[model samples]
Target: MAGNVTVDRTIVRAVTVFAMLNLLVTLNNTPSRSWMYPAGLGALGCVLLTLSVLASLRDCFRPVPTWRGIRVLTYISLGLMAAHCLTVRDLSPRDYPPLLHACGVIILTAAAAFPLPTGCVLMGTYAVGFFFVRLQSLTVGQALTECLVLLVSGATGLLLVALVRRTVSIVSTRSDLTQQEARATARALAQARERARWDGLVHDKILGALRNAAAGDSRRQASNAQTLAREALAAFRADTHSDAPTALARKLEQVADALGLECEIDIKQDQISSEVLDVLEAAAVEALTNVARHAGTPRVSVRAVIGQAAALLIISDRGRGFESQAPGQRAGLKTMKARMEAIGGQLDVRSTIGAGTAVTLSWSHEQPSWLTVLWDVRVFAPMIAIGAVDVILNVGLGLTRPARLFIPWLNPVLAAVVIGFNIAIAVCPRRPRLGWMLAACCVPLPAVSVLNLVTYGDAGWRYWAAGALTPAVGALSFRFRSSLGVSCCVASLLVLMVSEAILGRTSWAPVLGPFPVSLGVALVGGMLRRGLDGATAALSCENVRLAEQVRQAAGIAERNAEISRRRTALALDILPMLELIAGQGPLSVSEATECRLLEAAARDNLVAATLVNDAIAASARAARGRGAEVVFRCADNAQPHAGLRIFRSLVEQICATIGAGSSARFVWNGSGRDFIGTAVVLGHEASAIRAVVESVAHSGLLTVTCDEDSVLIQMRTH
Candidate 1:
């Protein structure tokens, strides 16, 4: 949608540039006209055109007021140009001044800036007036031909704008979809990490304390167990409240002190998400923990740097470092890597034995490349197609009047050269260096061709080379740099002016009449390139802002979910057990053991809460009764509701294969476009589980595989 706005702005600016150039050329040729029957009316028309051009240029960059007044001025200017044509007298139409040339520019401007119905009405009105005016001075066949050319030019402009709008719409839709997908993925990962943290809390704190109280015998041991349970309950309740935001430097200092190490810290602050800060603090703590326990040295440092759309954090230590291949010795490091990747950040660990270790975490907003956007096919194709049509029309008109050429053989040779250069310009967007070189070589051809092809003072389309071939030079030059493009246009204009003066036509009409069209083409091309650059920058910044908002929202949602889960566990399981212990003296050995088992079962529900149904829970209970260990692990918590029904069916099939004295672990992971469920069972043949899994037919959305000790089932989600 932003891109569509950019396109619309570019079209408006382009129309303004072309309209001003046309008006300048018309003003230069007006006073020297020897064909106008009434001079006063012609001067009045010229003044009106001048005022309209000035108004359009003044408001080119502003978007308010909708440019309606400028459009009205342009319509009056077009009518005046047509009226000037109608006032011509005592001159054959073929020998008349090129008054209809201004009509082409006006038609293109209207078509680009106005809606279809209005643009068509304007073009039709101008075309009918021009056709009727020409009919008074020439045959009907010639008049019809000129009218057809005017209409085709207008149609070309309409088609070009339509194509640009369609392309912009497609790009905007895809960009929205991409942002939505990124947000979805970030939310899923945040939920998964939150759930994992809760699982660890339940197992290490609540469940461990329950098991200890069950096995204690003496009064002192029971007292210690009771103290531990009270501490665990307090910590569980405290975790439900959210953490207040803190500065990165303060957080790093806290982590380092907790791990019993002194860290030299350097940080530059910017607007960073709490989610990102949490990951950085966690990674720093893990790295410092390694230094305290295994690095055998206390020399460590932490550095953080924030930029416009990026961030970097590094944790370094001068200790006895281990080999890179043995990074898995610290499982926390792998976990930090996954956490960083979940938020679209990068983690790199560098180390050498007997040297030191440096862990780097970095993130940056993704941006589109300038070269790729500049050379987009949607923009380039239309320019090339329009240039080819210009060449065809110019060469066809030149060939039809062979007697007008001073050297008859030069027409075909010039045509061949122009066509070859047009082809060369088509590929210049890809290889700009070559394009500029070609542009430089052709800068002098327009002036040289005009000098050699026509006799002195001949005025019958003798400057066709400057009109036709010089535009290719303008097109190719603008693809590189702005200074070079302006230089090329001015150089050609001056050389053609000098050539016209040498040919004894000292008036500005010969130089200013045909060459402004080429100049207009160059300026429009440069404007388009600049507009694209601005659009790319805006799109990149918008994406970064949207990503930050999504991450912040996900962090808040995960916190709320954790609070709800903790409340449920406290109300249903832990509170009743504490009440029983308070009423009686203490839990008996059998009752304590039963309480520990129930807590362990509740821990399972905390880990894979979404996968728990009555049938699955009943099967797990039966398996535990038969002296089997059953565990459920879910690394991705955002599962689609539609997939849950199918996941339940497939899970039921796997549970049927579990037998006595067998340990089973079921893992659910979501990555990219697929949802994978893995079942690892020991003390049972894998082929039986695989066969059972495959028996449930799925319509190409599910696949099952079995290795020596595991049966893996994968389902496609997108």
Candidate 2:
């Protein structure tokens, strides 16, 4: 797609070169013309051929060819070939002039350069005119045979160009699909990483401090609680600038001191971005906090190693460890894993009971594979089809008049060898050197064998296989380099000329008839390869650029969302509670318990605000009052904003089904097309909830599962 214009220009230039060669060959054989036409008419024919070549040259450089120019060139080329045949005077029926060979060049040029309808019209006009013109000099059967040869040439040209265009379109479509999938994957990962960061910040920093302060008992404990409150406030106000680089060792030391733990820190390399460093630091802090709370230890080790294009961080603690698959501990570990994965990193956690725990985070720059962008089967399929067609047509034509062959048995054998070599070329397109060798061995064998086997008397028709098979040399163009393909074409032309000279032919028209067509085909193939290569490179670079931009925008959006949520919590929850505590000196036992409940409610809102609408909130409050624990966990920010009316009704139904002394945990997971929400209920046997979940499932919007002690309801997020 990127180099379409370049490919078009390459095709036009090939056609122009073919026209020039045809014109030159026609002029070279003019003195040997057996027909007695006027000298002035011959000069006019020459002028038309020159004008057509010049017009083709002009079309080569322009983006779109002038339709009028194409029409004029077509008329002149077809008119000259017909005029040469019609104006014959005192010439033998079998002694056709050389100018008639120009018809093949004209038909091919029309097919390659003209629009489809116009090209078909021009080709049809040439076919009818040539048939009638040949009737003036030869019998109907011979005239029809020549007309068939000319038409086959045109059809082959048209099919080749059509296949090329179809393959280009397919490649473009595939490239677009690949880019779309890459962008979608990137966006999903970005959203997951942002969710992980926010979930950890809210759960570990804000909610943990609020719970501690509300449960404080002694005077020293209250002072410590107040300190935690101030620290939480400072965290809400803290902002990170990610446009600069960060030193890993210094950050880890500060994290260890803030947690009041003895930490052994080691740093090997420090060339990392601020964004990546932030993820590493947050993961390290979470690991250290886990050690302090669950590991029953105060000392830990933090190590970071950064390379030219990759980084790794490891946090280890020797304490009272637990099984890695413990149920309640997975939430924090899952958050850290998602955080690492969002930045194309991996997180590995290992622990043994009464031993230790180790968490490793690693990331690196990855490059896309070149094989995906370069080689395609679509391009090869067309080439193989065209090559097979060429072999079939030539073989069919050669067998048409077996009696005319000097040695019919030997001819088919040689033709088979040539076909086999062509097949070799088709199959070994990636191995150009080997293909060129096979092409060299095949080119001269066909030209010499076909020309020598068939007796030449009627203007080269008996040996038409020699010229018709010339396009087979062009098949090498798809496999070999451009220069090598052109050389093969030239070699085939030389072999044809030498074989024709051995047959005592004085004119060069028959020898040069199909050479220009073969050369043009080779040029088109070379241009196609170059165009696709350029397009692939451009697409790869663009994908890299787009991924970087998406990551940056995702980071900015994540920061902005976090800031907004923090501001809301400060103004409506934390700040008001702090003011009340300050005004009253200290909270009573009942007030502290109320504060804990309020903090838990705020935490639930931060987790899944979309799921906790006014109706759902009221229902959840009533369930809580009935001694039920209602929790919400959202993995990503895929809120069903457009389907809120439906979501609210469904959520309210599920909430009402919750009985006393029960527990419900609602979780939102996935993003984009696969987004879903599920609610797990335990500790109660409720037939009403099963009925409600099954009713929604029957409508195709939800899926319900029930166990002896629990029920799960899942629904798509819009």
RMSD of each: 7.8, 8.0
The TM-score leader among the candidates is 1
Q: Write the per-residue lDDT of candidate 2 for residues 1-718, one digit (tens) a residue.
A: 1325544555566566666777787787666663456766766677777787787677766765343444466677777766765676555576556666665576556666666676677777778877777777767876777676666667666666555555556666766676677667666666666666666665555555566568766564465456555655655666543567667677777767766778998879756766677777777777877776687888898888887579888889898878867622355676677677777788988888888888888989676643234333464565456556656665665566535666657766776776766666665656766866776775676465546554555434444454545555565665557666777777766776777677777445445555566676677666655655554555556656766776667667766776676677457656666545534445787668766766667666665665676577778766775667888776644555444455556667767777677888876654536446777888665567787766655457676788777887766664
Quote the lDDT for 206 in model 1.
Answer: 59
Instruction: Assess each prediction's global lDDT (C-alpha) against the native.
Output: 0.64, 0.65
lDDT of 1 by residue, 161-258 (tens): 66556545555565577588868976887786675455544544455456556666656446545654665566555653235446878877875775
List TM-scores for all candidates, in order: 0.68, 0.66
Q: Per-residue lDDT for 699 in model 2?
A: 50
Please give the range of 10 consecutive residues that has the lowest summed lDDT in model 2: 368-377
lDDT of 2: 0.65
